[model samples]
Target: MPGESELATLLRDLKPMLAEEEHGFVTIPIGSGWPQGLVPVATFAETEGASVIALSSILDGIGLEYEEGWAKITIGATSALSAVGLTAKIAAALAETGISANIVAAYHHDHVFVPWARRDEAMAVLENLSKVQE
Candidate 1:
């Protein structure tokens, strides 16, 4: 199915759901495999590093030092890459409340990573945004 592109529809219907796990982001050498039993929610290759986002426990278990307390918000819209303003809308809402958002757009959905301590507040902002008719 074609992804949604209309900004209004994207906001109104995009249910932002938070993943239950408390996550963290880390970077290790690209050639090394992830420590056993740890699954990353996302991973990326950078020129200087390989980045992984995974559960805090996994980071601790693996003996890799990492930044702690990140949370993911999965937007329930198959949004087209060309879709405009959705990130801005969500970011703006959070910004107004002094919360920062890190957004990742995948083929199937847009995920927002926020400070773990603020996940519930971020969800409330997104939920309220979804309730807006226009």
Candidate 2:
């Protein structure tokens, strides 16, 4: 098992970006069953039968208001082991500083959403990590 710091460091190879952390309409307990026409954006808490999934207000059917302070560090289309590297990097480095991250992987890029208040700090951390990337 890796330490949290180590995990954060490793995640950066995927280069998780800091995106505007907006308030998303969260649904819980996907249940053993799934919702019809459901597309989840961020999932955080999970229980045996329930999980929290956040859907951005951008969804056509969603009329909820969102906070747009989230950050998104983009992974190139060629990135390998994208999730592993991204999870490790943020968990190790930024997570310990009381910063929160919500990771969402899309078809072409991996998006990381951070608190709106700490967006600049998160971006700085990512920029530093990016400088050292291979």
Candidate 3:
């Protein structure tokens, strides 16, 4: 609601909560049509030719099929919408360090999905950014 600058400031003010969400992940081929049943577990990669949805499995019927090598770090805040460029900025930061991030911007927060091995480092970088940024 605020804005990118405001969101950054807010994130800076709040105590960083570094937690991990790791579990099943699957990439399904529903073509141009979405699957009608089964629940997705953690993350899903749905596609119709080139159009794709690397979406969340929070409350869907899609079942998760894999169980290794994925992690999520939630940058919790609704205002994160304002932090658009900032997300890419942080992403670039992670990228420079070779940590791939798959960002999911939910209604209430922005979730960054990273490789399981680099999750801790990713969290540290983000948390540190929140702290040092004024």
Ranking by TM-score: 1, 3, 2
lDDT of 1 by residue, 11-109 (tens): 988888899988888887767766677688888899867888888878888777888688999999778888889999999999999988988888889
- Top lDDT model: 1
Error of 2 at 16 (Å): 6.2
CA-lDDT, candidates in order: 0.87, 0.52, 0.58
Question: Relative to the unseen true structure, what is the C-alpha lDDT of residue 97 in candidate 3, on a scale of 0 to 100?
Answer: 86
- In candidate 2, what are the lDDT values of residues 1-134, reduced to their tens digit? 21222334344444544334343534444444655555665555555443334445443355433444344445432333333455556545678677787765554555666776787787677666666654
lDDT, candidate 3, 114-133, per-residue tens = 88777888878887777776
lDDT of 1: 0.87
Could you tell me every candidate's TM-score relative to the true structure? Answer: 0.91, 0.50, 0.64
Ranking by lDDT: 1, 3, 2
Give the higher-lDDT candidate: 1 or 2: 1
Q: Native-vs-model 2 lDDT?
A: 0.52
For TM-score, the strongest prediction is 1
